[model samples]
Target: MVYYAYFQGKAPDVTKKRFKTVWDIPKEELLAPGHRMCQGCGAAIVFRHLLKAVGKDVVIVQATGCVEVTTTVFPETAWRVPYIHVAFENAASVASGIAAAIKALKRKGVLPPDKKVKVVATAGDGGTFDIGMQALSGMLERGDDVMYVVYDNEAYMNTGIQRSSATPWGAWTTTTPVGKRWRGEWRWKKDIVGIALAHRVPYIATANPAYPLDLIEKFRRAFETEGPSLVHVLSPCPPGWRIPPDKTIEVAKLATLTGMWVNLEIVEGQPRVTVKVPKRKPVKVYLKMQGRFRHLRDEDIAFIQKVVDAEVERINKWVGEEAIGPVVEE
Candidate 1:
């Protein structure tokens, strides 16, 4: 009987969570208790940890997506920190503006300049990989002092499981469900990290809620950076991904084990990848665990593997590291 899985009562064991000590982290609350989110919602997890990293002197700009709606209902607000909800595609630019304004205010000594403020934008994969992409690219190219985090559950979860450019190839979404005659989602996930790297931001990293401490550390680092930074987070949408609520972190860990999400980073002072992905588990295990890929046949599975292989190979070449993910053998 662990005291980890309930709002106030008993429930099944959730994905294994590590306990924190008082000396390790503060008891500050940012997301607050009244916000509405699903059980095992990865976005909420990321949001909480992200706030913990940046602390209270931060302005959070969010898009009109799940996070924004859940936190800011018309008559109520759940955010303990200053927050602004922008249009679906404007979160990045709005964060950039907020950062610029904060910097100007601090320089003019309008507000207490000693209290360093961080500007963070939280957006889903759809807003990031689709609509907000251009604005994000522009922000990074201009080297704005903002941190943008994408809580990627791999689809448009806020809009009822529609496929997004971040959705994995074999995963099933409402629009890309595998029928009897069809294979699965036709296109591959857009390589947003590669695109971000091409822009050459000061820092770019991939994080997972399964690894909360790691995610928090990256956020702290990104928050302290002066130029534009991105932390691509892999969140688990249990209902959207057809996994059980208890398996949110499990699913996230499986993503890393399957090479579906690589935990790597480009540091501010370096041009090479400072982190490396470990030997990964089979993709089939990760795929079959989700009902979305229930209809994938063996050959179709092989095709997905090929796509992942090519993508990993390209990343390895870019990083000058030897290939570490799965490859098709003769």
Candidate 2:
């Protein structure tokens, strides 16, 4: 008697040896140069790495946000593949419609049935976790054959650095400013991944630009998955996060090392922590490095530490183990 699972032979191993540096990324560039992204834009890095992993046989639907605004400026467009720009709160919904059209076309022999084109929707925290939640939820609940990737910078970076639902606790934003009434963003970061998990999508994961290999691998898995896939990437914004341009990768690394952000994936309803942090660093090390957390008092920092510790504890409980976070060298 032979027993098996859907995980067996589901897809080929496309993760070519673990990637380490920027040079390890593919030479082919999908997003053309000469765009108006920031000096040390993490979103651009995420876009490039994801395109490298997903390849060119895809269609992209970009919601109105930083990436869309910066890349598509009227007469100038940076996208090299088939791309569409949608309203601020409807990228996923538009992508769903496109996917449905493709399926209908293929069935009617109007489009090549042998060729497969993946639908990918890109948005920021403001568009995804806030304004676009309804449409995004609809897409996920409907089980559309599309990938919704949210490049979470934790705030509305393009709109004067306002606070979005993805903003973490104790961080300062324009809206969640330090004042007599507000001590930075008092509310905790919204768990966008958890919301996606509730929909029980076929694939769900978290990625960070700091770990290029891991980020790229998650994209590959998302594209290969048949049903809806949600990938939440913690893209650090230089200005919004109040960090130096060059410290983008370093800051992002500290986030994972301090257990503030844990790399995870959900497959067949089984949760797994892909990156292992073994010995977690103190949250202060991660918070003190960012300017956004500069206003945090001793008590505030302690509060953040408690939040991080609780998050790490929760992840450990789910994985049924300890020290199970991304292995990034401190």
Candidate 3:
């Protein structure tokens, strides 16, 4: 899949040429450079990189959230392709409807028979894990030929940093503030990728913005999949995460290295570790870098570490082998 392409060395001629650059990624800007997104916004970078991979023959359906608010600021839009704005929880439904309509139009000869247009629905963690699950599930069950991408920043950052189901354990947010009553959000993060795999989507993968080639490759795969497909990206927010704006990519890289976030691909309900870590870094190396976890006591950090270790073990067991090496180039 394109999402896992960064891990692989072989590539098609086009991709090979693009990889000759310093970052081994394309330079074209489809999302434009002057958008209202915050400095070092991981989601914004994801959008830009995604468009560069797919080119101009795509339609985007965006749900109400940070990406929509910042990019489509009333009178202007940064998108160079066809873009549609939908309600917070209806992005999947809208994308499904658009995909179906395109088929109908082609059948009626209203459009060229050979024409191929891709439809992509995007949302944040709040929309995907909570408010939009019903609509998303419905679209997946119906086998809509649309790609769904969730730029998971782990909270409702647009709505004042409220804790969402995707928020990591022990992370601080407005509702999950650090105080005597609570050290941070105490619940486990929701597993949306696992839920999508259960729906039996043809393709599903997790990506990271730090690895641009892998991120764009996943976008290409999701668009090419025959049925509903999904790609979840670990988008880091500078202000919300209490990290330096320029450290977005660094933080994301640490997340995968520390085993806090695993990048995997699911095909026909089978999961493969795309970015394997032979010797995972300690979870504290990732945790202590962000202020959201600053309130965690030593025991709290230890508990988080144990959870990550168990997850890594589970993935290895599922694959029937230990990881051979790191997926991304160090």
Among the numbered candidates, top lDDT falls to 2
The TM-scores, one per candidate, come to: 0.87, 0.92, 0.91
lDDT value, residue 72 of candidate 2: 89
lDDT of 3 by residue, 101-176 (tens): 9989999999898898879999999999999999999998788888899999999999989999999999999999
Question: Which 10-residue window of candidate 3 scores lowest in summed lDDT?
Answer: 7-16
lDDT of 1 by residue, 252-283 (tens): 88777667777776664233332344565767
Model 1 pairs in collision: none
Q: What ranges in model 1 sit over 4 Å off? A: 1-23, 269-278, 322-330
Which regions of candidate 2 deviate over 4 angstroms? 1-24, 325-330
lDDT against the true structure, each candidate: 0.78, 0.85, 0.84
- Could you report the Cα RMSD, in angstroms, for every candidate shown? 9.8, 3.5, 5.2
Worst 10 residues of 2 by lDDT: 1-10
State in Å the error of residue 208, model 1: 0.7
By lDDT, highest first, what's the ranking? 2, 3, 1
